[model samples]
Target chain A: MEIFLQQIINGLVQGSVYALVALGYTMVYGILGLINFAHGEVVMMGAMISLSALTALIGIGLSPLLALPLSLMLAMAGCMALGYGIERIAYRPLRHAPRLAPLITAIGVSIVLQNLAMMIWGRDYHSFPQLFANRAHQIFGAIISDIQLIIVIAALCIMAGLMLLVHRTRLGRAMRAIAENQHAAQLMGVDVNRVISITFMIGSALAAVAGLMVSANYGLAHYYMGFLLGLKAFTAAVLGGIGNLRGAMLGGLLLGLIESLGAGYIGDITGGFMGSQYQDVFAFLVLIAVLVFRPAGLLGERLAERA
Target chain B: MSLRFVGSLLFATLLLAACGKSATDHASNLLTVRIGAAAPLTGPQAHLGKDNENGTRMAIEDANAKGIVIGGKKVHFELVSEDDQADPKTATIVAQKLVDDNVSGVIGHLNSGTTIPAAKIYSDNGIPQISPSATAVAYTHQGFKTAFRVMANDAQQGQALGMYAVKNLGAKKIAVIDDRTAYGQGLADEFIKAATAAGAQIVAHEYTSDKSVDFTAVLTAVKAKQPELLFYGGMDAQGGPMARQIKALALNVKFMMGDGGRTPEFIKLAGDSAQGVYASLPGVPLEKMPGGKDFSRRYEAKFNQPIQLYAPYCYDAVNVMIAAMQKADSADPAKYLPALANISHDGITAKIQFDDKGDLKGGAVTLYQVQQEQWQALETVGAQ
Candidate 1:
């Protein structure tokens, strides 16, 4: 029972990161009807940028506590600019072309971003500085580290904040309008391009925060860190229904919980034939099963009525 | 087809022939023995690769300084270094390039994944290849007479670590985790065998990928088993994080790993959590070995950097190859390989000799513990 509770905590923490990254994928797909494959790269750049900023600020004799938020903001800002630039330079040009063009371009952009990060940071794993005090509180004989608690709380706060932004604000209305009917939204005097860019900015910032939280939680960062995380998040988005906002969150958390629990129990359940080493196989299998069973996704509506 | 074009082409061919003849004659006047050193000079493992390359470079420089006269003419040793990027495919390409460059012998292809594949290329061309760091047991079992390594293989180190954990650490129940790489999986398999043989109950066995950053779920499961010790088979990058996680999870058990996790990098990554972790390093520590002090001083003076893991072994590998050449009285690989098979020397690592399977004859595994943020040697265990 303690083991199960421990897995639940681990799953929730892991799920939060997946949920944050999933928002980026879902938002872009919502507005542009394009799966921004480079969204993962945005997450990587967010971590890398923030790490460099934190390192620089700490090197200049600033306290790590003071440097933490400043580095995070810098990373968020950098990722926003990068997201806006990428959409403008790569996706915007191909918006009217065949859907395949923008999809392929997104992949190309992802590769370019990865290689660029590798060139800047070198292809080595770097230890991320722990910004918070390292401590764990036991809950029902299960341990919850301070970092995990902070990450889960921060993720929930961000999700709530995003929900309010998308549902209550004028920008939210414009975004919803565009997702509903781009031509009609433009006809209704919505600055369609501006709203799309704003959506990307918010999504990119969320990804950046997710990146920071993951790096802080794991205490390691590298160029390829975002690949698998991004892949799993994309799966999460699809499982919840791509282009659906709330569904992404649901999918992310569910995927994380499933992954953690599966990893924890598979060895015992399978009598040691399959273990934590095959943990990733379970996630991929979930993805395939979801795709096969429900092509439209659990929460995804049809193309015309997507919101 | 024009007369001028034909004349120009003929003149160019004559000039090329003349240049080739002069170059060959210049080479004949001063015999140049090329030694190829292939390593991942541009990847995550670049620091270690550079360390290997520097060791090989220092050996070549020392050999040249000694002015050994091979085949009557004064021998000038040239090192042909190539970057394998730690990729097995890139390693083979680098091996082919080194062979095309006509090197007398090769000194690396650092990782086991790279070395095993590159060994076939070197053996196909009858070139002797010595690995300074690759410790996988399968490397020497391929029947490639040319493949040689200076350090103990995973079988030796893993067995030593297992026995030490059970006997010395009093680990009655052991849980194992591996990163599922060729090196990690192979080492873990060896450890399981030895630990079980040593009468330790195997309670839990879990695995993770090399790129994994989290181990909480696995640890929670292992925690339930209430194992006395946790043995990991993987490199420092993953091991360090796993150590951090283990500490975070408050799993009251000792940690043990093989040579891959026995570097300073592991200590740095694990921070305060690295305390009391036991790791096995192949061969004796640098300060305790025969030529270790002289090699360290010279290497520091020459390279302006401390010798990372595997430098001393690399230095000895180059010297051992050179010793074989000297004994054979020829720089030709075919001649020296026979000498290499039987040649014994007191190298910086130990008595350098290969068994029939091209494995180190008396390879030793040194156990270490993290104390005060540094790896301190506990004891040197002889291969069983």
Candidate 2:
């Protein structure tokens, strides 16, 4: 029915951003075996930075058309630098320490980044400026807005570009070699640290784009926006099999579908005993079920063990 | 980083020592009257919290400028503000902190959930507390003599909003959504009761969280019900996005929200879709208040931004507290308690007086409709 179709569209749009952010988790987990929890704050940083950049550029009298892309690029660059800096300061210093040390440090970095962002932006819901004229397109009695459409396409194209870069380049080979065995990669002159840093930079850039998509879709942004999103995307990554690229993508989309459909019909499904307020339970429930049924996850046992 | 940390530590120590000295120094002619204010100053609702704080701060500044004497001693009013983060647990901790600091009176904890729990703390300490914005009916019914609010409660505002929807807007079938917060659920329940009693068929009722950013699933489900009007009981953070998404889904129903969505932030977030949306607030329009024009002009001149929602009510709450202290001729909460219970004062918003349950007597409710991205007042109901 149109309701089903509508849920699917919503799923695709939300899932695409989940997939993008999930890649950030999977890529770093593949190489460094750390969650890089601060990556979520990187996404928050992206939104805040891009919003400030857009306002500044527009204030300087540039047309919105020119300002939009320019702001996005600047945000990506800023996130890339942030990604490089976090790895250098937080992870690199503790790379040889006990694994728990870096895991805890990643959480520390996350808190620091969040507080830093709060201090800069001063805790308010910053309404995103309408980028362009919005047009809602109806398909089979289901509606999809232009921003939603762009979000899906942009996410897909970026995912494809990331796939190509991971599979078809010299750096991709180095990244794979490093993920396979850091010692072996280093012995083979792969510059393991450099490759890992680039992986993080690439992942952070994707998070930046996902951040913009999320803020654009909601028509607002805030300092705390990235926390739940980061957790959900991490769930998606684990659900698909952590450190597996294609699995993260599939898991992200499926999680989004499950969330949307479950939220839409929960009231009816439970005979009105439950409502959409319980929507958060869907993502974790799927995660728990996936972990119980297939520990290696869907399409996980027979692929490259890591991204 | 270490040097900066040490420097900040030393600075904090000095400031604390100075405050300790001030508390003990009734040795001087000037008695410092510290008024503790609790509100969320570092979250999504920070704008409103800051507005409340600014109003409270302005009142203190005005009182200091007047050089008021309490019990024949020159009193210097000081504000001791804390960020409750709008969490009840944090609010209790903040209340205890204020009690420890020996503040003469307490000013807030903006949300009903935070305010209700915090009221017990203030009452146990015998500190008079006033809320400028919390409107949950349960707050006043709790038998806490220390608790009072300047704004109308949910039962009154919801009744006004529900009746207006049926009689003025002619909404026969309605869908309701609440953010599941204390204020949201309470207001929605009251509105539903009043609307259903007035012969409006309740089509669907859904719930989301205060932190929700997306409403697509809930809206889609509600859309299938084919209601004539959709009402949401939540803050602007969720309401604005819901408005935008409602348009995206092309759901051809009239959109309405409670006072939580009646804000400039909502208009900015909802963009063009904000037009035609209706909201209800528990007050006469600012321009219609007794001293509303003068207070608004002074507020704008001081703050450099227009008053958002409850600034005048906050202003009134502070002045009413001050009036009680002046009438009692003492800064002690115990001394001022009787005076506050039986006091009537002319405030910018209205002639403020409280019923036996600490509820504002004859509080009015104003209905607003968005036109060209500005809130235009439709009508106010239930005044004296």
Candidate 3:
């Protein structure tokens, strides 16, 4: 029972990250009606930028406390600009073309970004200093770190902020209108291009936050770190019906829980023969099972048929 | 006019003969020995490959400066480098290319996964190939007479780590984790067996893929087992993160790893969490070993980068190859192959001698602890 509770807590912490990244995927998919394959690289870029900021600041004798938030903000700003640039250069030109064209372009952009990152950082892992080290609180036999709590709360805050921005703000209405009917929204003077770009910026910023938190949790960042996380977040987006914001969050948490429990209980029964090495496969199996049973995901919604 | 042209041609022929005789004198004065280095210069393991390359390059330069002699001929060694990208398939192709280039001997294919496949290619071609850092036990077990390794195999290092955990650290219960790769699994198996044999209870055995960043679930379960120590047989990329997560959970259990986690990169990745972690590397810190300081000084001067893990072994591999070639007195692979079998030489890593299976006989292992963000050598255990 303690093991079960422990696994649940572990899953929730991991799930929060997935949820944050997945929200970005679902949001961009909703507004743009295109899968931003480069979203993963955007996350990687954010981590790298934040790492650079932290390293430079620390090298100049600044405390981590002062560097942490500053670096995160810089990362977010840089990623937002990159997101805007990618959408304009890669996707905008093909907005009127066949959907497959933009998809391929997005893939091209992902490759370009990955190679650029490799060239810039080299194929070596870089360590990010722990923003919150040696700090954990025990709750009923399960130990939780301060970073984990921060990750969970930060994810929630980002989710709430995104929800408010998408529902309460004028720009959010414009984005929703564009997603519902592009031609109608354009006729209603929504400035479809501007709204879509804003959507990309918003999604990219959220992914940056996720990247920073993940690097903080792991205490290391690599160019390929974003690949697995991106896949998991994409799975979460699909598991919660792509383009459904709340569904993405739910899917992320659920996926994390399922993976944790699967590796914990089932693995123990097998004498740990079914270890966490297969955790990735287990997560995908859950996705396949969910998709097979419910085509529209947990919170079935018909937000955007194209995506 | 035709008679004058014939006369000019005769005079040119006489001048060419005189020049050819002088060129022959210069050619006889210089003997060039070509050695090949095959490694990943443009892939995921590029950092390691580049380090090995720098060591080999420095060795070649040093040998040339000394004017190495073979059979009374002044021989200058030149390195022919090829990038294998750390892929087995690519390594095989690079091996064939080196053979085609007719190199006297070959130096690398750093990873065992690549080295194993490339070894057969080298053996089939009758080329003597020595790997500096490939430590998979099965690498030397392939019965290839041409395959040789400078470092001890994973089983040896794993046993050393297990013994240290049980005897030195006084850990009664231990949990083991591997990254599910050949190197990782092989070492984990050895560690687990030895740890169990040493009266340590096997609490929980967990495996995670190299691609995984989060090990909370696995760590959480291991925590439940209440182990005194956690042993991870994996590279720094995974081990560093695992260390941080373990510390974050405040488990208070000691963490131990093999040579794979003994890099400065690991300390950087694990931050303060790496403070108390222990790892069993193959040799003492370069500054402590005999001739190590000289090697370090020369290596830094030549490469402009600090000597990384396995750089000394790589330098020694090149030196041993050159020594064997000097003894053989021929650049032909067929002649050099037999000569390398019994060759013994003192190198930066150790006194290098290979058994029939191409395994280094009785290598040394060093235990290191991460203290104040640096790998400080704790103790050395000679091979048993």
Candidate 4:
């Protein structure tokens, strides 16, 4: 019982990070109809930028608490600009070409971003000074840090804000219209290019927040940290139904829970038999099982009019 | 027309003879000694590989500056590096490539899993190979006469930590966890055996993957057991997060880990949670050990970064190899192998001497603790 509750809490905290990153993947797939493989690198860049900001402020004798939000905002802004720039340079040229063209371009952009990060930050792990240095509050026999709670709450708040924006704002309406039918939305006087750029900006910003939270929780950041996390988030987005906003969130949470529980129970059996090295293989096995059963994802809607 | 063609052929033959003679003379003037460095230069373990490479490179540079002589002929040493990518299969391929390249000697394949497979290839080819950091006991137990190591093996590290926990910390009961790699599992098993032999109760045992971040489930079980100490045998990627999670759970149990989790990166990853954690490393820290100050000054002068855990061992391996070459007075590996086996040279880490199994003779393990973000040397235990 206590073990079960504790695993659930752990899963939820991990799920929040996945959900935040998955939202970015789903949103870009929603608007652009292309998998932004470089989305993970964008998250990495945000973390690096935020880490640099925090390190610099600390070096100059400023309190980390005051520098935290400022660095996060700067990181988000930088990521937004990078997202827009990559879309314009790499994706825009191939917009009229075959669908595979943009996908290849995204991969190229991911490599470029990774190499750039390696050059900027050397090939070493950078430790971020602790953000929630000495703070924790347990609940219901499960230990929870303030940072973990912050991450969960922030993810929910972001999802709610995104929902309200999509359903209420003019830009949100334009985005929805574009998603439904790009040609028709253009004919209806919706600036397709502007909406696409704005979609990328919002998604990139969300990834920045996720990156910050992950680095803060783990207390370490590196050039390659985003690759695996991004991969897991992509799996989540597909599991929840790519291009489905709510489904991405659900998938992220579900994947996290499944992984935590799998590690807890299945890990013991394998550890006792073979050793614990096989614990990582459990997550991919779950992913394969989920995709086999639900190709369109758990919450994905059936296409009313299949193209 | 026939006379003109014969005249042209004669002229071309004369030109070829002139060029061939010049090329032959140039080859005879310089003797090239090729040494291969097989390491994980590009992967998750690249950071450790790069440190080892730096030490190896510095040794080669010093040798070249002094000029190596073999059989009364001056020779230049050439280092050829291949990236194994920290995979055993890739390591075999790289080893075969080095063998094909006909390198006189080889240095590396940092991980034991990779080194074990690669060593077979080197042995089959009659190439002498020395590893600076592969500490698994199986690496030496393979009975390869050509294989040698500069650091103490896992058995030594395990017993050192186990003894420390019992004698110094007075731990009555201890829990253990391993990341399940061959290196991790082997060390954990040795530690458990030693602790149990020393009359400590084995309360709980768990395992985690190298990629796992949340350790709440395992920590909760361990906390329920209420062990006096927790032993983790894994690298920093998993160990750091485990420490943080344990602290978050408020377990308050003293944490001890092996050399794999003793890097500065661990402290960075665990933050405040890393404080007061004890670890068993293979040797004393560079600053505190005798004869290390000069090595430190020289290493810092050459490489800007601080020397990492295995850098001194790597330096010693290179020194021992060079010393053997000088004694043999030949670049032929068959001649140098016997000389290398009988080495007795002082190094930055310690005196270099290998037993019949190619394991270091009289090697020691030192205990360290994280004190205010730095590794402070706690105690040293002689070779088991």
lDDT of 2 by residue, A1-307 (tens): 9998998998888898898899899889887778888888899899888899998999999999999899999999999999999999999989889899999988998888887888898666788888688888989999998999999899889888888888889998888787788898899888878888899899989988988888988988888888888888888888888888888898888888888888899999999998887788877887888889999777563334576
lDDT of 2 by residue, B1-384 (tens): 697776565556444643431232333565678888888886678878888888888888998999988877887788999999888899999999999888888889789989999999999989999999999999888899999998999999899989988888899999999988889999999999999989999999998888778889889999889999999999998899999999989888999888899999899889888999999888788888999999889999999887877788888888899899999998889999889988899998998999988889999999999998899999999988
Cα error, candidate 4, residue B88 (Å): 2.7
Stretches of candidate 4 off by over 4 Å are A61-63, A96-101, A267-279, A301-307, B1-28, B284-290
For each candidate, the DockQ is 0.52, 0.71, 0.54, 0.44
Question: Top lDDT: which candidate number?
Answer: 2
Q: What class would a CAPRI assessor give candidate 3's docking?
A: medium
Of the candidates shown, which would achieve the greatest DockQ relative to the real structure? 2
Where does candidate 4 clash, by residue pair? none
Please, what are the lDDT tens digits per residue for candidate 1 over residues A113-217? Answer: 987987898655677876657889999988898888988899888888887877888988888889988999999999988998888888999989998888888
Candidate 1, residues B1-40: lDDT per residue as tens digits? 9977765655564444322111122324445678899987
Query: Model 2, which residues run further than 4 Å from truth?
Result: A299-303, B1-27
Cα RMSDs, all models: 4.3, 4.5, 5.6, 5.0
Where does candidate 1 stray beyond 4 Å? A96-108, A180-189, A301-307, B1-104, B294-307, B322-335
Ranked candidates (TM-score, high to low) = 2, 4, 1, 3
Clashing pairs in 1: none
- Residue A195 shift from truth in candidate 4, angstroms: 2.4
The digit string of per-residue lDDT tens for model 4 on B1-384 reads 696676555455433432111111122444567778877776455667777888888888888888777676666667778888777899999999988877888888777778989999999988899999888889889988899998888988888888888888999989999876668788989998888888898887778755556677677767766898999988776778788888987897999999988887788778888999999888666765567898778888888887766777777788788889889987778999999999988887887899999998877898999999998888788933
Shift in Å, residue A18, candidate 2: 1.3
Between prediction 3 and prediction 4, which has the larger lDDT? 3
